[model samples]
Target: MAELVRVAALTGYFPTMQGLGADPRPMLRECGLSPELLANPEQLISARATMRLLERSAEVTGCTTLGLRMSEERALANLGVASLLIAHQPTLRLALQALTEFRNRINSTLALQIETFGEEIVLREHFALSSPEPHRQSSDLALGVLARFCAAVLGDGWTPLSVCFAHERPSPSEMAVYRRLFRCTIEFDSEFNGLVIAEADLDRSAARADSALASHARELISSVMSPAMRTASQEVEQMIMLLLPSGRATIQYCAESMGSTVRTLQRMLDADGTSFSDLLNRARMQLSSQYLANPRTRITDVAGMLGYGSIGAYTRWHSQMFGISPRQWRASAARRQPQSSAF
Candidate 1:
């Protein structure tokens, strides 16, 4: 099935492209989209097409940070109904929780996972589209918008410890744009794409938080969203993506995390015409493409990241699914890139 996200994903697309001296209309048509669709933020559109458009736009305009440029002007209001719920939360932690809870309504393919360790917190954002195509632009835009949201709630004094990107670093000019916006350490070609902040940052009180308004917004959202906004299979797929790197994506583990027994979860997936193994394989397929594409990642490490117990097992399975050794796939991916391109 084709994955869909809200039209709001392209909120600043038009002006951003025009600012870079390109006509975005042609790009929209190329991606099977229309300007009319951008006019309605709530409309559902093809997530893959949206990703292609952002990537192609960046290529044509020679603006490596196209997504971040579009994200510069995004305010909480751009989130529509979600803005109310998030903005009124008393703490950054709760606001982010609200954002994650209502994320499917905003962008169905986007997922956020929060991890805490000692005195730090990592806000990991994943854009899990069905295809293994590039998502660099979307990743940048999502992180940029997330930074804006955090700063909004925490006041201007907010600054994360660092921002990480799975993709390699860009040119000096592009790096300047990133440094200016994030105002912190920027790590590229990292294991993940996310923000690292002090754990205390999440507890900072929101100056504008209103319990009354938050309550009203919560009630309104509950009334508007159906209980079946996401399918059982889709939810499990999300869990698999987040847990895959940690080597704990087993059905029993996921079932326990979701507050259900393994048998009950299996029955739900049966109704959806899929199984836990099917979803796990799909997630591995998509993620392996990403991991292998990064030359800095070791094949053995990639195996561990995919939850394989040994290199031989990862190699055999990858060869069966992709018809090539992981090393050969990485070489081919590297060859496909322009020598002049930094990433």
Candidate 2:
């Protein structure tokens, strides 16, 4: 089975803003979640609960636009913190580097990575396990928010070079909408999901940048780090590493092994800012290196032990995570080995 993405603790960004003229309480209650739960930023809800909330919120608000709105809300709510890192860094590259580092503090599930390819800056989304159902919606929502957030930070005219998605082939309708929203090319069903921006855009100064503002933003993000650290979760991570070789691990199985209810296990993981799905992928990524190091292990067998349905799936995931095929990885590993000297 494909690994699940975790989104519990990260959902705390869905604040219950009383004055926003929309009562998020009824929506939360319907999903068996509470607005107060946001207070415990470490607390996590189940993927089921998160999906229900997303669907119900759309139903309640009568807005097909909730995904983008939620992304923007998250960006706006956290701008104070983001500005601190983005404002003072010596260059846009460094600012993005800091943003990538501190992204977990906001939502650990929103896996953010910055890559530079020639003149382009790519902000990739490694989706978390607990993201909303209909994975395409969640992926698109993430990309939309990121594009808007960068524009907000760098100035209104900022645009991306291209936006890419791993699933859902881009349609003309989506292309038109995406182009209108981001003013960039939208490529779907790509090898990865991320946005590509021109390198020059990073050098453009934000409308608001000053030492005092930068210092204040830094202080806020810094203060949150301690509390975030205190609540970090490692049990699921440990369990995931253990189960990767066996490849039969399920959420229920993991909970049983941990001696807890599934809900309890999920909650603990959420508090730690991760989920079973995220942990599994991470374990596979880590173990691929070890397994690939052994020439005796066939790529097919490695895929089976990792619980992949087929070697193709495993190879695709491996390439996405490590940027190389298993065959290539194994070949590279062999080349790096020191030869024995028979004196």
Candidate 3:
């Protein structure tokens, strides 16, 4: 099943695109979405379609910063029912914790990983879409919205230590907009897409927190959670995405990560009509396509990124999957794509 995201994700999409001199309705229709659907913010829509809409809109309009533009007008209310819970947390850290806990309810495909290293905090955001399509626009939209959220909750004084993107840097003009919005250093072609924050920033108390409202919001959110909100297969797919680059995506490590034994994890997957190997293969197929389509990404690096032990193994797997070597596949993809832009 395709993961669903709330229509609220596109809160300012219409105006943002129109302001860029592009009509988003045509692209929305092309992606199986409509203005009526997006107007009903609580309605769930296909995550893949939403992502594809953003990418297509950007391409058609030649607006690389389309996502970031939409994010500029976003507010806490854009988070839908979970806004109250996230807004009332006592500190930035607590608010982020709320977001992590309720992420499935907010956007089933979205994943948040927060890690601390000494005085630095890293908040990595990922969308576990089952497709091989590029999600640059959606990724920018997410990070931009997140930056705005932190600013809204923590006050104008709050700024991340740095913002990072796994993709290459945009043009100088586009970078200016990014710098203006983030108000901090920006790193492109980095290991992940997320914010790097100072520990003190996250630890500081939130001036707007209301304990009673937070408790009430939590209750409301908890009441709506159901088994359908997430599944074992989805959880394992996310784990695979995270563990792949580390070369620890084996079933044993994945089961351990889920606090389950191999047999128990297998049972859960079996109940979901899948297995560990199947999920892993799907994840590899999705990621391999994305990585191979990027001309700058070396085949050896792609192999490493997909957790292959060696280039030969990756080559053999690629041949089996695509009936051609990685080099041929990359060449074919390059031929299909138009000339690269400055981004």
Candidate 4:
């Protein structure tokens, strides 16, 4: 689950760049991005890659407000399944609540928090990532998209009382874009990145809200959220991933987590052309490679994370899977990376 995001997270990027007279392919390739990989709305891409793509594209295209420009084109349908649920929510408050719960369906690392200070309410946008280096682009993208979401749910004329960002102030040209996009008092180098508005605004009911549709959509989104209906194997793999660090990546644990019995889980996995042991081992091998590639990670620490109780046992399993000791594998991985990226 290493902070992956669905490709729909970039729902408005392609058209935005094309309209701006920029060919995004070269920028994407330089950042190790593939346009074809984004064709499938349900396909997962590295959140890090998404962040890097935005930063590099902005730098290459000389668009200081690149992220904001892209997010302005976002629509309600860009939310995927969550759109149905959010569309019918009775009020802006409830819609944001739905977003807090279902944003994971879009980006696993995105976090939205709402807090009240007196009559003024702040809806903070932050990333729950470890050391999210170069976050300004993503932050602006999130803010613009959120403003669009609020306007879609409320009305196009609805605007926040103020929009804030922790990043330094933009250039005069960029500030003009920001003011035009937000249509509200824009504060830069603020205490945090969020939207501030009167609490009364949130309480206003949506003109087109439908309680019945919202209820049904919530049920469907909640039940189908766990598995994107991809495959039983992938479902099981994700389950094992969440349980591995807790040393509970067993068949019983995976089955229970998925609300199925061990027998039923095994049967479903078999029907999907996979076995529990094979899936678990594959997940471990993949995660091990990713973890060992980080120089700051210790082999013994990786072993514990992979559910191995002893370093010797972990080394034996590593050799069985890749025909090399973890140390040697890490060395090779380091050599393959650019000198400037060894971090």
For all predicted structures, in order, the TM-scores are 0.91, 0.54, 0.83, 0.65
Candidate of highest TM-score: 1
The stretch of ten residues in a row with the least summed lDDT in candidate 4 is 126-135
lDDT of 3 at 285: 83
Model 2 lDDT per residue over 10-57, tens place:
332355233235687787788777767656534544545665576566
Cα lDDT listed for each candidate: 0.86, 0.60, 0.83, 0.78
| lDDT tens readout by residue for model 3, 285-321 | 8778867766666889999988999999999998998
Stronger candidate by lDDT (1 vs 4): 1
**Tens digit of lDDT per residue, candidate 1, span 1-343?**
3488888888888888888889999999999999877788888999999999999999889998999889986889888778998999999999998887677778878878788889999997876765587788998899999998998888877889999987767888777779878999999878777899999989889977999999999999888888777778878888888888788999999999889999999999998888999888888888788777767779999899789999999999999988998988888888998765434
Clashing pairs in 1: none
Report the lDDT of model 2 for residue 94: 59
lDDT of 4 by residue, 4-25 (tens): 7889888778887787789989
Worst 10 residues of 3 by lDDT: 334-343
What lDDT is obtained when candidate 1 is compared to the true structure? 0.86
